[model samples]
Target: MSAARPAGPVGGVTGCVFPPATEARLAPARRIADAVLFEGYVLYPYRASAAKNRLRWQFGVLVPPGYGRDSGEHSHQRTECLLEPRGPGGHLAVELRFLRARRRTVQRAAAPGPDAYLTVPELELSDRVLTPWDEGVPESVRLLLPLERLTRPEGVEHPFLLPARRETEPVTEKGAPVGRLRYATEEVSGVLRLRARELPGPYGALRLTAVVANTGGWTAPPAGADRADALPHSLLSAHLLLALDRGRFLSATDPPRWAAPAVAECAGEHTWPVLADPEGGDDVLLSSPIILEDHPRIAPESPAALYDATEIDEILALRTACLTDREMREARGTDARAGAVVDFAASLPPEVLERLHGAVRSLREVSPVPGAADASGEQPWWDPGADRGVDPARDTVAVGGVAVGAGSRVLLRPGRRRTDAQDLFLDGRTALVEAVLHDVDGSVHLAVTVEDDPGADLWRAQGRFRYFQPDEVTPLEAS
Candidate 1:
């Protein structure tokens, strides 16, 4: 392939297309605009065929917002790729490499000239010669990048580690930022959304985010040294996101397949949905160390969870309906005065509780037409474990008494493990879970594991049934 005529880093080396042998070094690499960059660089004898001590270098990149194709097929990408000389360069006695970084006065390595080199004593993958630009892609929707580098010699610090975690809280004066975690909260529509952020080790990595729902009664528990008083509750929804650059690279490292999109790349929002872990390389980024602290007096800390407007069907029969958003807000007020006088959700009278649970269950078990073939039978990928909103209960959450697919899903708070008969039988074993489910379908399934959101545990909630969507489940046998 021809090398694209983009300005070279620092100095121009008249990049050229390397022969197959030399190109093989950059083998297993992805396509660039016109050429393929070696994942990193390598050095050896210049003798057309012999291996001598030569210089080699490579760089990992984290594509920021507004990167590749912004529309059409290649939207939402920060493709992980490489760039290198099409030809040779510099003195072989002492080798040097360069990488483009966010704006900064280039820092120097132990060597010279603004830290010309970098070193990593450890990396995620070893022995398997991590060739330049040879890294694979991941099938995730929101991809966050923090690239890490390695050094050939000890103490030779690479300059890239400086520009990380502007958004993260530092661990301590003496602590490395590797294992530390952070918790944050954002409120919308009077609901407090909790988030836990973590950055950890050894490589320039991808961002991993999970969103869950607070199905249980209490809030998520804070993370810190064991808190004897912490309440554990399972969460509801979870959604994961990963980002990408141009759509020209392979994703995943194991049995690797091309994750590159077929059209020109674009940058914007997109969703990857589902992904395989082993196939996708461990992130190309690493977060420095950090310390985690949980403070619940400020806000109840609980398991990470996510909830969307689509699934509110558990039939919460309030003593009176709010009717309007304003009324809802007033009734749900968090004011200290209101809180002091209002009855706690747990303290509601037995009649009210019975009424509420009964209404919800009634909605859950309502059949479409007096038991017509239970359209939700054993079909392809119908696990009785997913949250199938009030569809099966058409008489309640439907329009004009017509049956819908899965209008909303309701999960009881506080996780509950299942007995053999309770959960979806996986190899004859009860499915392990911490979620409560209530959907259009009469059956209530349990929330097993979610995709994102580190918060949300269901251990705190008392006895309550969950929703089960027969159509949305992916049974182990099918997978």
Candidate 2:
């Protein structure tokens, strides 16, 4: 189900209090904006080898100019925003920081003279040659002078450069022999800085734009560049740090429902966004977020009194159905963690177990005519009612602990044990029960549409529906 966007600040904060609609809220909004700032932020199942990973680098792609010409457009390397300040008479300061690789160029002399070899007399010395002597020596003479005596009298004396050979080319007995000297080597380091200026406002919002580029001349050129003009390129990771002061930041982004608890906590640290462009691209470079902790495991059962036993069983059953035989084998062959998952999937009832296995095998087959299999005096392959001996007539029908049937409005109970992905987003939420399907086993499942879910149509053109066991919901009494 799609989550309702929260109107106010979304992140939990520590330290100072934030003004209404200010920096506190601004942080989270920025995070949400950053989520799309880079391409391929996340993939389904989120495994490294998942098929969706092939589509990585789908967002925040900053392609070098002319690189993506095949697509008729170049990627944008900059993003800007106009942020409203929470209060009047305050200044705003922003610092945009991102990862930059170190690049340097070395310059060597075009012509180097023969290396000069100098020898020193027996004395400690700090440098090979001592310059600015009280008296200059004739180039014709070789001298071994005391370095310490020249600098300070009475210290441990050291011998300075004693020119061993003065190679001279006599010219007509009139010109002094000329000696060539070597030039010193030099290196230049690359640099990148975020630039912005203070703009005066009549106590309102201010504009902030961040530009990322290859400022250094030594960067490698983008792909498909002409060889003559091939320039160096500099790539940056997506993880950026934007420091702001003076104005209270308000909304930035809302937390994603699919984020694990650990990811959510890191996002709450006032960090803008989490993952970005896990699959790398030369045109679109991104910085990965630092994940300091792992996600907490959802418990198999909860001891809280409000926890629903029937809902737990149903969740376990559905989860088991989702597992493939290959996954079961892998789990069994792997460690305890995999074994636990295998154990859970193995706990489904016999009829449901067979249905799961059949579904896996028939994923590519066309569906048979509705009730055709049943008409043949055989149970439907996908029937959820097969082998159920209980009768619904003798069982009580309930929603949220209240006896309910069609047209009954009930508030979803909060704090239900979330043992499955389907249950996680529904907890503490409300839904309307459009219908109730009773199985031959006397178990009732509510067909509900969450008030907040933004429905979508797949290739089959069927609307997504959410179901819940009666015990998972509680009755909302009249006030």
Candidate 3:
């Protein structure tokens, strides 16, 4: 993979291959990428019998076209990113990564014969419990494309395949063979199409579009076939890592004002590209099926991948710590990764747990107020109630020539700028204003509840209500 080489389509390349010197170059990005790759590989409680664990592969699943077409799952993902190449001999290295699901079936000998075995959902051995599980085998396809070749009208198309595999592992009970695990996976085929075109902007930026599709042959499943049936032939957690030889890639989420228009034109389907270099370089871009912000990272305090990325590490650790001995055993027996998570959670010291409790990502310097701090001398800015200038309950905003405040009545008329589609249904509905709120930006909002809704009282009791801007409501006459 050389930048000086002429542009041409490279095919039949399979494996986790990184450009020269890029393995270390992409280390930081790979850490976050690994988290994304196995975002939901397994859930907390980690036991195969857990309800949440039953339905797996929630993210970045590119199922067979035949199954996806009818099931609403996707068969492909597309990503578009902007880049500025400093030289004509520049090149792009793309690594397409995904998981291949392997179905493991537990089997027990029926009559002590070598070939005679009875399939079972689970087999309890002397040492552990064996349950039928679907495991993900990491797979990747690497490609190096010349930027000059991508500029061609026809672009470049590369096809790749992951061959089928089958294996068996014997399970023993005190050195005696009791059962075995049969693992099988179907062949998965996919193609990547990359095209680059010059943008109309003065920045001389180039837009690169990469589309990855699952072209594996699949027979339409039976009427009752579920995701588990189609999963073995699917690409789980499909994502791409793109590295530039000698250019910088612009942020698609937060581009500079001058490049805003060009960034707006960038589009994607089931895929989003974000700047990946943790040091703030723009040479590496991570295109993921999971939408992520620029330079997304795993928290340093996070001890391990809990599969529930949305959960706080402290909370997960605490929850895992409280699991029953039987539950822990079940989790440990479910999969090797699950066993590792269990061990990791149990080994955290008090100080490590405290660190995982929380960390303030950033803070702003607040000017000292004469009487802001108490005897403790801690900053009062941490407490919102410390600020006495604002009161939501007493705030008032003029609407339709009326001073609308708490306990006022208004008719909702959601404006075209409405943020939620449900707001349209509230249009022309009578609502009781609970409070007039002012945001930090000095914008006024009227929090109200539908007067006729049966849950109006409950909503007020819970302090939950819909909010509308000053112009989105009209003051009604007092009854």
Candidate 4:
């Protein structure tokens, strides 16, 4: 579901445990004058043990790094957030944050340690963001534990940093991004290109594929008079750079080209360039992993807690505090399925895939399953069973409904355990299989299929949980 609150070693120093008077006063970084202050930021869904249990909130939208160190040269961005509020069936929701745990330092790029926070845009903390039964304060638990669709949609891209009007630019090269830039598109053909393969052994570069056309809207009328779903999505997926020491763009098959990138590996040549995030000029705003956190199918207020998950690293440091780039565009036309072909063999040229085909059909469908090999192998991308989940390898997991509340982590379906398949990998793509969650004397029961299969192997209906960690949860490894 996009659960990432692991912001501990980006720059250094996030030691605020909480309780020094809330850091003199406001302190998420002195407010930065008011930063981008979009329009939303509020989370308060309690009931870690019991109060009545309603608690809802699984938000994550960060994009800080307004640019400082030198402004023109310097790689230091800081923006941290963590909400995690799930309770009703999934469980795990205990708030209480007033700020103040000691150790300070804030003038810019702050929050490297002490919960680390160097935010500036729009300045938002939501008072307590979420508080409950606080004696003094420091009870901030949200390290990922209630995933099953809990609101994470805002597609077209733009994870955080919105204010320049909307933000959208920086296709690459503004102050040191390596070089090579220009996506320009009109769908002259298929648009979605990406050529730059560096594969000697461990993959020093790893990136190869082309399906481009134009850049946005203007094509698509063949799938057979298609209209409803209109289908034509394009996504290359590949970004691995955990950032503890060496991180930047990963999706692996043989990563660590001294660069380290092998997060899912559905193939061996994908390439995303850290998402390109985009950059042209106007204002700036970047971050948007996929999209469709939820689209009208409603039905989620809360449902977390399988036995307490431990805050999930503060929710991956609030999902990387947003991403930040600045300069807006909204998402450029939003991508009306006008371009993106991705033909590995349309003869191989015509400018290859036509140049930029709606930015590669708007690119956005790169599956995952490769931390090692086979946490169980197929049938788990959300649980696509009977085959509604699509089936790139097995299926999507179940589609939705067996149990998923919060809003849209992907449509919620949290429940799984038990792995091993060389580790796991998905060179095939497509994921689903969402719940398995066991244990009774303690609480937890959500199965869908697989009445029982160990040596026999039988729990079909689509699968993919990739990486748990109570002892050894691969999540779906294999690249």
Candidate 5:
């Protein structure tokens, strides 16, 4: 559900794929799942005119059958996960969640007559600002099934349809209607299919596959039509939630040695499955369109969901708090959720803002060095700069039978593993080495500035240099 799409192909078949669980059982995971649900629903400086906002719905988009090929988006997505059931008797509650697109257009009228209406991009009623934009409505389809039912050779299939509709809300001045907003949506149809097969491992593991597809009956857009024209017929940010009565799901990402083989055999298209329970139990698995680690949880220090999960709360909050009145008004008019973010940022107390500044999620004991302590006593373990033994300027690394350190010269030969695209242009260029550094993991790196670069002196003065592994460069001379 982010603006940046993950690299992969998408596929689908649908129904309940997990066992039945009570509301209380789902409450914890539901909170984290909601964050995933609206990960990029809106962004900072939220406005309909923003370029980023115009290209929305980048994750788990399921366009109608024939339209996918034309639009370069998939109509379905599949989730393949490994489960180690404790016994043969087990049940699963499957919940499919996604968003349906709603197209809202502002309209104006000179008088209260049907023929007097004229389409407009925006309109103001009193202090309220209205603008034309796309909005998402949440939808969920769920089912529960016995483990035996899913074991059948044919598996199980369930088809569903969300009917289409059109709505009109009046814009009023005093008691009379002045203008109206028209909301239109298209019918969405999809099917869910679930199947389970036993693995060859000693751990009685089973590979479970769940597929969700878009079967909506909509014609493909014409040759020149863009994705915006097909949004109404698509399922936005689709993902699955599964709860089990008995059985533990092995992590597909970090499975035990024995189950690794089976995990490799499991095929997943577009979506990935990870353990969902924040408490570390494996009974729940979230098959999301966006990749996530096992037992993912939101930080408690966060005050609100800003729709950009990858960004830091402190930076986003500060940026939102600094928005001018005009920008705030446009953001408030963009969507109700955007308006809430603006209000939350403006109302944050000093203490609450400080909390968002930072938090320590973990701490570890460090073994003291004989001479690590001084007059001020032992340095704080969190301060890496306190280590007096390390000096980048005096450090040396062996490259091509030469000691390369500060003031050394080298030929830039960046390796095949292209970490940055700009590295391609730097290959074969000469550079002046600024430092030989060792990371916390004990890997050596050379920091250098391009010899021919106009800003080389400025970069060297600011202590900023491009970094490369020892194997990526050949030493030419040592200063």
Candidate 6:
């Protein structure tokens, strides 16, 4: 049976994870789980080729065994997600939904001579295709493709002269055919139903695993099997649908605003923990505190605190600043949906128009330098202008609550462990500030070289000089 849809307003985080093109392994699965919980799971201005997009597949990933292997019997793939319900003891249920690719073997009859008409006597042609899901889970869960007749180049539609046959079987031998199909069957699609069950506990953690296997035995053709070139295995989409008991739970897409203070103070910017099993199992724990309604210290504005009260004003301002008259007119062309979005963006308060322009101007100022530009292009406007010969002794500023300037020594703050290897590792280490630079965002940063290194040269043009934000360093006092 189809699972019931989630009722009432619901809030939760949803994101895409990388699918394993080959066999799903434990290391990659763990990494995927960690990535999904990482901050900035998906960045603004989402594009596939964006720099941020390189960090794709932060969610859980699963792949059938024997995938990407030269020769091996394929086995089922499994994925698990761990969840924690808020508040005291109560029952909880969740619905999982994901996209699975449908596999079908397409065949076309060879061309017959101009004078010849293709005809065949009544004969049975049976073949089995792979079936990925278990039995008793009603078939035809979704119609990704409707059943239709196959057409030839001559525009002749071949009719199914006899009833088609289908059955599910196991893959007892390597490279065995699974789903049975006849000459009349051109293509087919597969469907999956939501699997739900009661959690062991409401307040405690629960693990959910989705297992996919090619239970049917289907052997690919010896040759010319374009569809079978790659193993015909099902895939799961990253979108997950979660349902919580009504009136007993509170959910939000983003962390609450009160979380901001903690986030800022965090040595590393990670706001969520990797939900992996401590015993090296497939399941992982999702580690974010769930706010409860009746908590003694819970504030009424907690729910709305993270949201900007003037979001519409800011968005309207942004629209006016970014879109030209021609572009605005073009946005309304033909497509009613596009026009509606543009109209809504344009309908902002008049009082915020000036502020909107200012915001846009600031955004442009901090935009990244073009690829063709040299290092000088990154220089901020606040740097010394035409009078480039300013006295160094006269320039002094406070960074991270400490006085600093050229020749000043500072200590780097410890940062959390990072997988990207980009984390500044000079934590607690002292360095000499060779220069202080300001960026367009009105933030000060220090360029420093290691104090003890013999080759500590900042002028080599390609030396290991590092820049740190004001908050990431503190001025070292004189001995």
Instruction: Give the winner by lDDT.
Output: 3
lDDT of 5 by residue, 386-417 (tens): 67777898988878778889998899888877
Compute each candidate's TM-score over C-alphas. Answer: 0.16, 0.26, 0.75, 0.15, 0.75, 0.26
* Candidate 6 Cα deviation (angstroms), residue 197: 11
**Per-residue accuracy of model 2 over 353-455 as CA lDDT, tens digit each:** 4443321333534335553445447756455454354333233464444676545556666344644775776677877566567755656776666765655
Instruction: For candidate 3, write residues 1-479 as lDDT tens digits.
Output: 00011111122338556666777767788877878877877788889999999988888999989888888999999998889998778878889888888788999877777988899877875435678888777777888778999999999999887788788988888788887889887899999999999988578889999999999888564666887788989989999999988898999978988888888888899988999887788899999888888887667777567766466678887899888877877877687777777777888899888887677868655546643765576645445566676677887888877899899889888987656889997889999989877766768888898998999999999999999998998888742
**How many residue pairs clash per model?**
112, 32, 0, 157, 18, 22
- Could you tell me the TM-score of candidate 4? 0.15
For residues 1-479, write the lDDT of model 1, one tens digit per residue.
11112221222121233344423322222212011122211111111111321112112221211221221111111212211111222100000111222111111133434323333221112111111111111111111222211111221121111112112222222332221112221110101111112123332222222221122222323442121111111100112212122111222221122223311132212222222112233211111011111110111111110111111212222322323433223322211112211223324555544533322223333234433334465222233323243233232223123322222222223222433343333222223233434544545544443323233234224333233333333233211
Q: How well is each residue in 272-341 modelled by candidate 4, as lDDT tens digits?
A: 2122112211111111122211111111211111111122213322222221211011111111100000
Give the 10-residue window scoring lowest on summed lDDT in candidate 1. Answer: 287-296
Global CA lDDT computed for model 6: 0.33
Give the whole-model CA lDDT for all candidates, comma-separated. 0.22, 0.33, 0.81, 0.21, 0.80, 0.33
Overlapping backbone residue pairs in candidate 4 total 157
On TM-score, the stronger of 3 and 4 is 3
lDDT of 6 by residue, 222-315 (tens): 6533222322232232222222221121112222353333323323111223322333332222222111111112121121111111123344
> Considering lDDT, which of the candidate structures 1 and 3 is the better prediction for this target?
3
Minimal lDDT window, size 10, model 5: 1-10
Residue 468, candidate 5: how far off, in angstroms?
16
Stretches of candidate 1 off by over 4 Å are: 1-240, 248-310, 313-331, 335-479
In angstroms, how far off is 207's CA in candidate 2?
3.0
Error of 1 at 322 (Å): 5.8
Model 3, CA-based lDDT: 0.81
